[model samples]
Target: MAELTLLQAINKALEQQMEKDKSVVVFGEDAGFEGGVFRVTAGLQKKFGEDRVFDTPIAEAAIVGNAIGMAINGLKPVAEIQFSGFMFPGYNQIVTHAARMRNRSRGKYGVPMVVRMPYGGGLRALEHHSESLETLFAHIPGLKLVIPSTPYDAKGLMIAAIQDPDPVIFMEPKRIYRAFKQEVPDQEYKVEIGKARVVKKGEGMTVVAWGAMMRETQKALKRLEKENIDVELIDLRTIAPLDYDTVLESVKKTGRLLVVSEQVKSLGIASELITRANEEAFLYLEAPPMRVTGHDITVPLPKGEHHHMVDEKRIAHTIKKLANYEV
Candidate 1:
């Protein structure tokens, strides 16, 4: 085992996967020579050579479109979009082709590819550099959405995504790329997609979050402990095939739920989870499910970003308020 940052773990996963499967190839804007915008692909080109690891033009559509073709022809192409907000240009290819390859062909062919992009806020980046658009992709059918909150899961899930038989959108929260470190196994491992991780267990309430928000929520939970507020914490590793079983089980025990996301409040992951809870565990609720999310507007510039991003203070206040509710 080795202690690695989230970024390092991502690179390690790619390296290991490529080593194990010669069909695995990685490419994107500056992914080869430059090692990607955040260096998550650092040294991959050197290890895998130009054929297995290369770069593409600055076109998101072309990048994904080509990867889809590669996947159909038996190559596992891991494509990276510089940022989540920049992925819109390739939305047509992603939703129309890559996501539909398997079903459209009636199981004759599958797009066994992984589209990796850095997402979410707290990085003080430019307008298009900090978007949390996981919800948009999660809404599309035949596409798996995954987000990891720690180095261990980051490595394991990346390997799993590459091995999956269908298209997957692996959204790496850039904010936590180097925020923390964890001991990750040197050998390859798989963190099954469509499963949520229970980071902490408690009987009072259940707090669900993923990506960067998971770190913030953890800080809030630590502070709430001083007030004797014990809450269950769940890190939703994957969003599309949501792990409703884990969430429902925890909510049944806690009788309350609070979902947190950096994306806008309306029609986001939080809303989807709340709807699931209402459908599956409404009678067990002690209070209406709550969400601590960003505003329903474009992410603000650095000068005003604080007003739009969720933080430890906001999450702690919301949890305390919900914990005191008498409903």
Candidate 2:
């Protein structure tokens, strides 16, 4: 095991998979010669040659459309969209074809592909470079949405997504791409998809988040620690196939649920989690489920993003309020 940053870990996962499977191909805008915008695919082309790892034109639609065809032909294609916001141009291909191929063919074909993109804010990126639209893709059936907050999960989940039999939307939080480092295993391992990881055990309340928001939530929880506010924290690694059982169990024990997400407030993941708690854990609730999320507006430009993004102050304040409730 060696300490590696999230970016390095991702590059390692792609390298290991390409080495193991001949069919695995990596391509996107600057993904080959440039090693991706963040260099997450660095040195891939040098080791695998241009055939296995190559660059693509600046066309999201064609990029995804070609990946769907490759998957159907029995080749695993891991295509990067450069940024999450750029995925809009290829929405038709993803929803109409890549997602529905298996069901549409009655199990005759499967789109075993991974669409990796950097998402969320805190990078001071331009408008289109900082959107967190995971909810849009999660609404479509047959697509698995995953967001990893740590280097360990980043490596394991990427490997798992590549091996899965369906299309996987691997949203890597740009905010935490190199935020910190952790001891990641060199050997191949899988952090099973559709599972929520409980990072801390507590009985006072439950705090749920994923991606970059998980880091901010951790900061808030650390502040609450000084006040003796023992709260459980869960990382919903897979957004689409949500691990509702882990969330419900925690709510049952703590009697309070607080979900945080970078995605704008509306019909998003936070709303879905609130609905789940009401449906399955209402009887055990000490107070109505709470949500600390971005406002229902387009993500503001970097200059004013601080006012819109969920930070440690907002999360901690909300947690304190919920803990003080007398219901």
Candidate 3:
């Protein structure tokens, strides 16, 4: 086992996958020699050589389009998009071809490709560089969406995404890329897709989060510890095929729900989770579920970025509200 940061975990996952599978090739905007914008692919090109791990032009469409073609012909292509917000140029390819290939071909072929993009807002990045668009890809069927909040889950989930037969949008929360570290196995492992991890068990209320928000939520949990608010925390690692069973069970036990995300509240993952809780566990609730999320507007620039983030103060306050709610 080794202690690694989220950034290092992702890079390790790619290295292990490429060495294990000859057909696995990685490329994106400055993904090769430059090792990506955050150095997530730093040593990959040197270790695997330019053929298997290389860079691409500034063309997002070309990168994804070529990945689809390669996957169809027996190559496992791991494509990178510098930022999730910038994936729009390649969105058409993903939605039209990569996502629908298996179904379009009637199960005759599968797009075993992973599109890696750093997503979400926390650090004071440029406006275009900050966006939590999980709903965009999760809304589409036949495409898997993964967001890991910890280094252990990052490696496990990335490896699972690489090995998956269908297309996957692996969104890395850039905010926590180097924010922390965790001890993870050096050998290969997979945290099955569509599963949620319970960070802690509690009886007061259920709180769900993923990616960078997990860290902030955890801090809030600690602050509320003295408040005697027994809260259960869930890390929703996969967004699309959400592990609703885990969420529902927790909500059932806690009888209260609070979902936190940095993305805008409208039409977001929190809405979906609350809706499901209403549908499947309405009677179990003691109070209406709550959400602490980003404002609905274009992500603010670095100057005003803090206003849009869900921090410990916001999360702790929301949890207290849910804890004290009645009726």
What C-alpha lDDT do the candidate models reach, one value each?
0.93, 0.93, 0.94
Candidate 3 residue pairs in clash (backbone atoms < 3 Å): none
> Tens-digit lDDT track for model 2 on 1-327?
999999899999999999999999999999999899899999999999998898999999999999999999989999999998889888889999988998989999999999999998878888888788999889999999999999999999999999999999999998899999999999999989999999999999999999999999999988877888889999999998989999999999999999998888889999999999999999999999999988988889989998889999999999999999887
- The local distance difference test score of model 2 is 0.93
How many Å off is the CA of 210 in candidate 2? 0.2
- The true-versus-predicted C-alpha distance at residue 209 of model 1, in Å, is 0.2
lDDT, candidate 2, at 48? 97
- The TM-scores of all predictions, comma-separated, are 0.99, 0.99, 0.99
Q: How many residue pairs clash in model 3?
A: 0
lDDT, candidate 1, residue 316? 98
Clash tally for model 2: 0
Point out the worst 10-residue segment of candidate 1 by lDDT. Answer: 221-230
Where in model 2 is the C-alpha error above 4 Å? none
- Per-residue error for 139 in candidate 3, Å, reads 0.2
